[model samples]
Target: MRPVVFDGQFGWLHPAAGPHGVVLCYPFGYDALCTYRGMRRLAERLAARGIAVLRFDYPGTGDSAGDASEPGRWRAWIDSITKAVALLRQSTGVERVSLCGLRLGGTLAALAAQQLGDVDGLVLLSPVLSGKNYQRELRAGYRQWLSMPAAMDCTPEPDTDEFVEAYGFRLYREALENLRAVDLRRDAAAPARRVLMLDSLDAARVDALAAHYREQGIEVERRGFDEYSKFMMESLDSEIPRAAFESVENWLAAGSGELATAARDADTHLSADDPQGHAVEAGVTETPVWIDGGRMFGIYCMPHASLVTTGGTPAVLMVNTGAVSRIGNARLGVRFARRLARQGIASLRVDLGGLGDSQPSLDTVTLDALYAQDGANDAACAARWLAARGHPGVVLLGICAGAYVGLYAGSREPAVTGAVLVNLQKFTWRNICDETGKPTVRVAAIGSTRSYLRSMCEPRKWLRVVKGQTGGWPVARELAARCASRLRATLADRIERITGLELGASEERRPFAALDARGVPTRLLYGVLDDGVEELEKYFGVRGARLRRLRRVKVSFREHMDHAILSASAQENVMSYFEDFYRSQFGEQPGAVADEPADSRDAGRSGRRARAAQWLARQARAFRLSGEA
Candidate 1:
C-alpha cells in the first residue's frame, strides 16, 4: 500500500494481486473517527484476498485539503467515492470494481455506484436507511458523550436544522439539508449487479431496503451482522469483525474470475512545483514519506517557500494521541500542521510503529506498548528523518500518550530543543486493570473519582445521597483518595526542598526534570479540569506552579480544554498558543534561504544504528524510572 494524493485528497492505493479491486467508503463524523483503523484493516484484508483497494479521506475531512465548514460536503463525499473508483480503475487496471461501505459510507457507496452505472459489485454494512434517523442518532451520541467525565464545558450551539454534530465533527446547513431529504430506499437505485447487505440487529429497514432493490430486479443477499457492536467501538480498542469482513471477502471472491496483475498504483504520484513534494493546498505541499526503514509512515507538511539551510528553523514533530493516528483525536494534527506550513514552518505528523498506518512490529500491539519508550523511538526516528532533510532540529509536540512519548524523545534526541506536552495523563506506567480485564487508561479510571466529587455539589444527587439512595461509601472513598494524594504531594515537596531527593507521587516529575537538566525548553498545557491535572498537582503543585525551579519548563492550563482536544474551539486555542510559541522561539517570520539537498539515504545503516542506540538508552532510563516508582 502506498499513499497517493489526488483531487486534493489523501488516499491509500493497495496494489492488486488480481484484476478486481474495490473502493471502501467509510462512515462519517464520529463514526469515521472510531472506524478508521477497522476500515484500513478491511482494505488490507480485501487486497490480500486478490482484490485491490483504494481507501481515502473525503476532501474536507481527515488528511484531506478542506475544512468541515465548507459547503456541499454531502455531494463532496459522494463525489469523492466516484473519483476514488475512477482512480482505482485507472491505476490498477481493474475493470471489475466493487464498493464496500460501513454505516453512512454504505449510503454513499450505493449512491456512487448508481452514479457510475456499471459497478460490478456492492457490499453495504448496516448503511443508514434514512437521513432523519441518523441525525437523531448523532444527537443522542453527542448528548451521551457530553456527559462523560472527559467532556468539558463549552457554550452550546443552537439546536436547529441548519447544523448537526456529534463528537467534534459537524455537518453544515448544506450537508444537513441533504441528509434531511434522504430516504435511501426511495431515492437510491439498486447500485450493482451483485449486492451484499449486512444489516444490524434491527432488520426491518434492512429487509425493506432489500425488497426495494429486489423490485428493481437486482440480486441482494442480506444477512445479520451481530459483530457490528464490537467492531465499531472507539478506535483505541475497536475489534476487527473478522466474521463480517470475511463474509464480504468470500462474497467478492466467489464471483471474481481472471484478474490482471499489472498495477498503475505506484505511478499516480502528485507532481508539485517541487518534484519532492505533492501540493496539498495553496502554499503547502504534503509528501507521504516512510521512516524507520519503511516500518513507519508520516505526512511531511512543508511550506514551499521555507528554505531549510543548516541549523534552520526547528520542524514540529507530532505523534499519535492514543491510537487515533497522526490526524489527532479530532483531526487536530492535520489542521495544525497545515496552519504551521502556512507560517513558513514545516511539520511532520507521524504514526509510530504499531499505531496508525505504521506497521505493527509485534503480533499483538497493546495500549501499554503504544505508551512505551519504543513509541518514543519512532518519534526519534521521525526527528532524524526531518534532520537529514535539512531540519537539524525539531520541537516535539504531542497530547495524551503522544505527550509521554514526546518528553522521552526530547530527553534523548539532542535535535529536539523544544517540546510541548498537552493534556499528559501519565509519566510512568504501572499496568493496572479495570473491571473489564483490560489495562485501564489512568484517565478513564480517574474519571469516576471526579464524577463522585461533582455529584456532592449537585443538589439532586446530594439529596439522593442523604436519602441513602446514592451510596456514601463511594463518595467517602473518593474524597479519602484525593486527600491522601495531596498529602503525599505536600510531603514530597517538603522532602525535596530539605534534601535533593524526591519522594512519593514524584515519579511524574522525572521526565520534566530530565528535560530541564538539559535546558531544553518545554511547555505543558492541560485543561483546567482535565483528569491529568490531579497528577500535575501531585507532582508540580497547583497549575504546575512549583515548576519555576525548572528554568526551562513552563506549564499552563486552558479554559474548558478537554483532555482529547475534541472541540474545534479548543483545538484553535492550542494552535494559537503554538503559533505564539513558534514566533517566540524562531522569529516573527523565517527568512527564506536556499534549499539544501535532502539526504541521499535517510534510512541507511548509520541512521538506523543511531536510532537503535537512542531507543535502547531511552528504554533503559524508562525501565529505571518505572522500577524506582
Candidate 2:
C-alpha cells in the first residue's frame, strides 16, 4: 500500500490486482489513532483477497490537511469519502467500489452512500446510528477519564456551551449540533446495495439499522462479532479481528467481478522519484521505507524541487512521540515534515523499535522494554541512513519520550549535528529490581505530585479544590512517594560520589550533561500547561542554568498548549520551532567529514535486563498505566 492525496485528503492505496475496490474510512479522534494498525492490516488482507483497498484519514484528521477543531469537520469528512472512492476507481481502473468503516467511520460511510449513488456495497462495523447518543457517550467517557488518578495533574476548564474536550479531541458547538442531527435510523434512506452490519457490543441498534436498510429494499446482513474491539483497542498486541475480517472478505468475494490485470501493474515504490505516494500538495513526496536492517519502518518526505534538486538538503529525524506512532500527536510529524520539505529540507518520521508498525511480535523486546535504551540505537541508525542518502547534516527532533530519546541519541551519534527536544520529562529512566536481583528498565512517570499540588495554587484551581472535586488521599500518597523517591536518589548519588563507588547508573548517565559537554546546540520547547516544565526545572538546575551556561542550549514555550500539542494552532507553533531549528542547524555550506568506524556497541537491548523486563511487555500495552501525557 502507498500514500495518496486527492482533493485535500490523505489515504493509503493497496493495489489488489482485482476488479473490486474498497474505501476504508477510519473512526474519529483517538479511536482512529488506536485502530490505525488494525485498519492497515485489514486493507492488506482485502488486497490479498483480490480487492483493491484505499484507507484514508478524513479532512481535518490524521495526516490529512484541515483543522479538526473547526465547526464543519463532520461535513468535510463525509465529502472526503466520495473523493476517496473516486480516486480508488481512477487509480486502479476498478469498475466497482465498496465502503468499509468502523464506528463513526461506518456512519460516515452510510452518509456517503446516501449522497453517492455509485456505491456498490457497504460494510459497517459497530456503526454509530445516532450522533446524539455518540456525543453522550463521548462526554461520559471524558468524565470517567477525568475521575482517574492519572488525570489529577491536568486542569479542567469550566463547563461550556460552545466547546467540550474528550479523549484528546475537541468538539465545537457547530460540530456538536451537526452530529446531534445525525440519526440514520430515522433520517437516512439506504442506498440500493448489499450491506453488512457487524456489532461488537451486540447492541439492538445494529439490528434496527439493518432493518431500516432492508425496508428500503437493500439486501442487509447483520452479525454479532464481539472481537472487533481487539482490533480497535489501545494495546499494541491487539490484532485485527481475523474471523471478522475473513467474514467480510468472503462476503465481498461473493460479489466479485472480473479481475483487473492492471492492478498489479500499478506503481508503489519507495524511491524519491516515485509519484505513486505523492501527498495532497503538489510538490511533496511521501516514501515509505524499512530501515535499521529492515527491522524498523518510516516515511521519508521531501519536496519535489524538480527545478533544482540538491544532494545536501538538511534532514530531520522525528521519533515516535509516546505511544502515538510516528505520526506524532495530532499528526504533527506529517504536517511538519511536509512543510519542511517545501523549504528544501528532508524528513523521516519513524516508528521506534517496538511501537506502531514495529510490533513486539517482530522483535524480542516490547516498546516499554526498549523505550529507555533502543532510542539511541534506533536514532543513530536513522542518522547514519540519512547520511548515506546524501543529507549528512541531520537534526534529531521528538516530543515527550521521543525528546528523551533524541537527546541521548544526538549526544551519542556523530551524524546528529543538532537536536530539538520538546516537553522532555526526565533525563534518565528508572531500572526496577526484580526478585532475581537483576534490574528491569521502564519509562518513568513525569512530574511529581508536589508539582501538581503547586499548580493547584492557581486561583481557578483553588475554586475546584474548595468545591471538593479533588481526590485528597491519592494526591497526598502520590506526593509523599515522589518526594521520598527524589530524596532517596539524591542521597544515593551523594553517597556514591563521596565513597567513590557506584550505587546506580541513573545519575551517571545524564544525557544533558553529556550534550552540554559536547557543545552540541540543542533547543528545548515546552507547552505552557505541560508537566515537563516542572521536570525541566528540577533536573536542569534553577531556570535551566546548568545547561544555559553551556551557551548552546535554548528554551522556549508555547502558550495555551497542552503536553501533547493537540490543537491545530499548537501544532503550527511546533512546526515553527522545527523550521527554525533546521534552518539554524543546516543553513551553512557543506563541510568535509573525516571517515571513521561506527560504534561497535550492540544496538539491541541488553540480555541482562531482558529476563527481568518480561513483564514490561504487558506494561507497554497499558502504556499510560502511570501517566497519559
Question: Against the true structure, whose lDDT is highest?
Answer: 1
Alpha-carbon deviation at 147 in model 1, angstroms: 1.0
At residue 131, what lDDT does model 1 achieve?
77
Regions of model 1 farther than 4 Å from truth: 258-276, 306-311, 361-365, 432-437, 440-445, 448-452, 467-469, 498-501, 504-507, 588-629
- Count clashes in each candidate, considering only residues at least 3 apart in sequence or on different chains: 1, 0
lDDT of 1 by residue, 476-550 (tens): 776687768766766666677789675654566677788888877788877656778677766665445456567
Per-candidate Cα lDDT values, in order, are 0.76, 0.68
Q: List the residue pairs that clash in candidate 1.
A: 19-259
Model 2 gets an lDDT of: 0.68
